[model samples]
Target chain A: MLELVSQMFSYGFLNRALLVGTLVALCAALLGVSLVLKRYSMIGDGLSHVGFGALSVAMAMQLAPLAVAAPVVVLAAFLLLRISENSRIKGDAAIALIASSSLAIGVIVTSLTSGMNTDVYGYLFGSILAMGAGDVAASVVLSAAVLVLFVLFYNKIFAITFDEAFAQATGVNARGYNLLIALLTAVTIVVGMRIMGAMLISSLIIFPALTAMRVCRSFKGVVITSALVSVVCFFCGMVASFAFSTPAGASIVVANLSAFLLFALVGALRGKLPG
Target chain B: MALISCKGVSLRYENRLAVEDASFEIEAGDYVCIVGENGSGKSTLLKGLLGLKSPDAGSISYGDGLEQRMIGYLPQQTVVQKDFPASVYEVVLSGCLNRRGMRPFYSPAERQIAGRNIERLSIGGLRKKSYRDLSGGQQQRVLLARALCATEKLLLLDEPVTGLDPVVTAELYALIRQLNREGVTVVMVSHDIVCAVHNAGKILHMGTGVLFYGRAEDYPDSEVGRRFLGGDHHA
Candidate 1:
């Protein structure tokens, strides 16, 4: 394991992967707590699909992928918010509508232009080697911004998530905070899609929070535990992927799943113990 | 002086007229209960008072130094909140978010206020407990503590006692009554006309509009109030 760690860090792409992956994991886990509790977990999945479509369009246009995908996915996130808030369309239905349509558009765009090339394949399933130095810098800055914004608005986020109406009544701007959450989620999704792929980026957002909720009783506890769980699982998964030559994203998800199962077992046993 | 005055206010929910041409005034230190049958716009009117919903017609004015943000609100639990993973302290502390304005974190003074409200409600022992772990009555008390942290003057509650048992309901009403006696203005929405008449100083009976608005003492004499209270008597 020590030899593998040394060898993994020796590779520049692996180092970039680890750096960006860990930061994205932290951001996803933090936002995931609110998203899961609000029952908007699928928004991550929907927005990732939107990110994929944007990425595909950017590739076909020969434009900067990150710049193109980021704004488009953010716009889609706002559109999802608007649809959920205004119309008869429920949140889940709206997510499904946008997600499926984006996926369809991405598939058509890829088939029409890219011809199922390795670049498209890399994006479809994720490739750690796909990240460049510029990509790493972008991810780092965006992740830091997400972290700062999250920390700054922690109380407002909690107030809105816990009770939106009550928050609004107290002049907390619940709608604005909700929009902030969506914006952060969109940014996280776009940042994560490069490493985790559109198909699996949302798992990074969801699994850690669910795993933490199994054992943590309070919101702060859940958030802290989720962040730790996400970082550790991502690290372990990255190591395993290096050792076994497996896919990094899938390996991370597997690590998270194992942690979730272990925590669930502990939670169940704790529930049965006499006080 | 009136803390809140609604003059010919009408509110729409989902583009349908849920409340029509409702007019009432809530005086400072008043204990007002808006009572009506299901779908009678009691909760809608409460929303209007809290500024959560604007009047589609007419206006709601706040006076006597009252502002929308200064109004404490205790909304009925939503499905998401039932299983929310938050400590009682965290939930109560969030009430100070409005006053926090632009500051990222809670000030020490805000924390003190949360602690005071928790102690005021006698839930200091449960401050560290997760809100989802509390009993229904205890949850209500935690939320009440949260509301108290928001404002010292006015509280707007929407069907606060809906899920609690009879004993817990009585206890909550008594708690609110005690607060009102201590000069905290309360405007609660409840279907229990008996409890409303018993606790509130004023009652606003509604059936898609303001059927009656006056002193609680006169409510029993009023036709709408008499019918509602008499219906509850047999119920």
Candidate 2:
């Protein structure tokens, strides 16, 4: 088992996947707590679809996928937030509208240009070999920035998440912080989409937070637990994917599912115990 | 000078004029209860006073060393807060975010204020407890402490006791009264005119406009106040 683990990391592509995947999972988990609690969990899913559309455009235009996709997804995120806030469209409906439209655009663009090539398949379903050294470098830096920003604005984020109206009343820039959250989620989604796939990236954003919530009670507790859980699940999933020849993204999701169920059981048992 | 003064204020909510031509002033240490029937624009007027919404045709100004952002607000409970994962301390500390400016963290002074409010509200025992796990009454206290951390000058409460039991409701009212006695001006939106009359020194009744705004002692003599107060008795 130890030899198998060491051998898996020996491959440069696998090493890069591990490095980038772990960082992406960490960023996803931190933002997931806020997104899930805010009922904006679908924003991650929506942004991933937008990321898919941008990736198709980038592939067609022969531009760097991350460069094109990142900005495009961020803009789509801002538009999604604006549409939800300004129009009569509810948040979930707005997400659906943008997601379906972007997804259709991605399919059409792919069909017109790449015509369902292997690179497109990798983008849609994710591939372990997709990360180049440059992608890895970008993911690392972007993930670090996400982490730092989250920490720096932790209290304000908590203020808004818990009570946005009260936060606004107290002079916090609730709208600005909300936009910041959307922007960060967009960046995280774009970076994670390479390994987790556009289809599966949001799970990286959602599952760890939900799982942590089953056992943890406080926001700080849930956040810290989510970060740890995400990293651990990614590592185990990667190991399992290498060991059993399963897809990395699916394996990670399954690992998160197991953790969620396990934590739920533990929570139930704790509820039965006397104080 | 009035801490908050409104003149010919009209607020449009959901593309309709919810509050129209409303005029009032809240003096320092005044305990004002805003009472009205459903959709009468009491909440809308409160939002306007908080500067969350702009008046379409009037001016709302803050005076006597009060800034719009410095006013403590305890808004109605939101669905998002029902299952939110937050510690009591964290929620209370967030009240200080308005004073935090560009700092990345809570200052020691901010922490001290949160601690003091926690003690003030007597929720120190639950400081580390998860906010979601707290009961309705305890949650109200925690939020009140949070509001107190925002300012010593004023508090605006929106239906602060809507769902609690009668006992908890009375306790909350008493707590608010105590805060008012300590010189924190309060503007509360209430459906219970009886409780409002009991606790507030002033009443501002709304019915698409300022139906009545004056001293509580004189409320029974005012035409709108007599009707509302008599209606409360019948209900």
Candidate 3:
């Protein structure tokens, strides 16, 4: 196993995949903290579908999928945010609407071009083994952008996530921060879809945050712990996938779930046991 | 001049008029309590005052240069799920976020202000505790502390004591009266007529309109008061 791991690391493709996957995991974990806290975990699910729909349409038109997917996903996210604020519809219902409709649309569009592209299945379930230099570069850039934005707006975003009305009353534009959050989620979905796939991306956004919340006391603690757990999970998953030739995205999600189950057991035992 | 005045104010949802042509004036430093049954527009009036809802045919004028920051509000105690996982300090500190603008970081001064407000409200010990894990009375106190962080004057409370025990309710009312004595204007909406009559100097009896707007002492004999309080003249 050690020989296999050393040999994998020696390969440039494996090195690049590991780097990109780790960065994406960290960024997603940071955003995931707020997403989970705000009870908008479903937004990641919906936006991933939106990304998939965009990819299908782009494939039909012979365009770069990311170029098509990014803007469409962002616009869908913006609309979802606006609709959620309308007072007529509940927030969770709005997310449900976006999620179901986008997934249906993606399926229909992909079916329409089924015979044209044989590579569509890889997009649906991810193909990290096929990740090239360009994909790695794109992943790095998108992750860096997400990291910088989170750093710059950490306090404001924290305020919005906790109590939007209070944030607004104090003079922070809660609406603007909310919209920015949706945009960030969209970007994350589009970038992460290549590694986790559209179907399994929400787990990548949820599990680490859940693990962090189980063990951490403060918001900053959650963020740091979540990022650490995500990086560790990504590397373990990558190594498992390489050794057993398993699916990369599924492996990562399974690794995260395993960590979550371990943490949950510990937490339950701690609750029952005397200090 | 009144600090806030509403003239011919009316609000409706669909074809039903929630408040019909209600008119009143509230001066600074006045402790006005609005008493009414559910659906009598007590909350609607507060919303109108906060500009959350626009009256169909009324004008509301604020005192000159009174920024929104001058008004503090404690909304009704909502039953948040127990798994929300936010600390009492984090929730209270959100009040300072408004004053901090869109800046990415909280200044030491802002943190100090939030800390002071939490300490002043006597929830300083619970600052690190999860908001969801706190009892109902404790949650109300934390929310009140958050509102205080926004402003030192012009407090507005909407059904602020719904689920609390009577002891906690009385203590909260005492806190409000103490703050009012310090020159913080207060307007509260409550369904507890007995408590309202005792605490409020000015009473606004609202039922589909401005039935009576005067001192609490004058309410027992008023026609609208009779209709609302059951006309028995008993405690």
For model 3, the superposed segments whose C-alpha errors exceed 4 Å read A1-6, A86-101, A104-108, A111-118, A273-275, B10-20, B54-56, B79-82, B233-235
Model 1: TM-score for chain B: 0.95
> Tens digit of lDDT per residue, candidate 3, span B57-143?
978777734566557778775333346567888777777665765566778887898899898888888989877668878888887
TM-score-best of 1 and 3? 1
Instruction: State which candidate has the highest DockQ.
Output: 2
lDDT minimum window of 10 residues, candidate 1 chain A: A82-91
lDDT of 1 by residue, B1-235 (tens): 6889888999998778999998888889999998888888888888888888888999999999988998889998999988888999999998888787798888899999999999999999999998888999999999999999889899998899998999999999999999999999999998788888989999888899988988999999777866777755442
Q: Which ten residues in a row have the lowest lDDT in candidate 1 chain B?
A: B226-235
Off by over 4 Å in 1: B231-235
For candidate 2, the share of real interface contacts preserved is: 0.95
Better of 1 and 2 by DockQ: 2
**Measured with DockQ on alpha carbons, how good is candidate 1?**
0.87
Q: How do the predictions measure up, each by TM-score?
A: 0.97, 0.97, 0.90
Interface RMSD, every prediction, one decimal place: 0.8, 0.8, 2.4
Q: TM-score of model 2, chain A?
A: 0.97
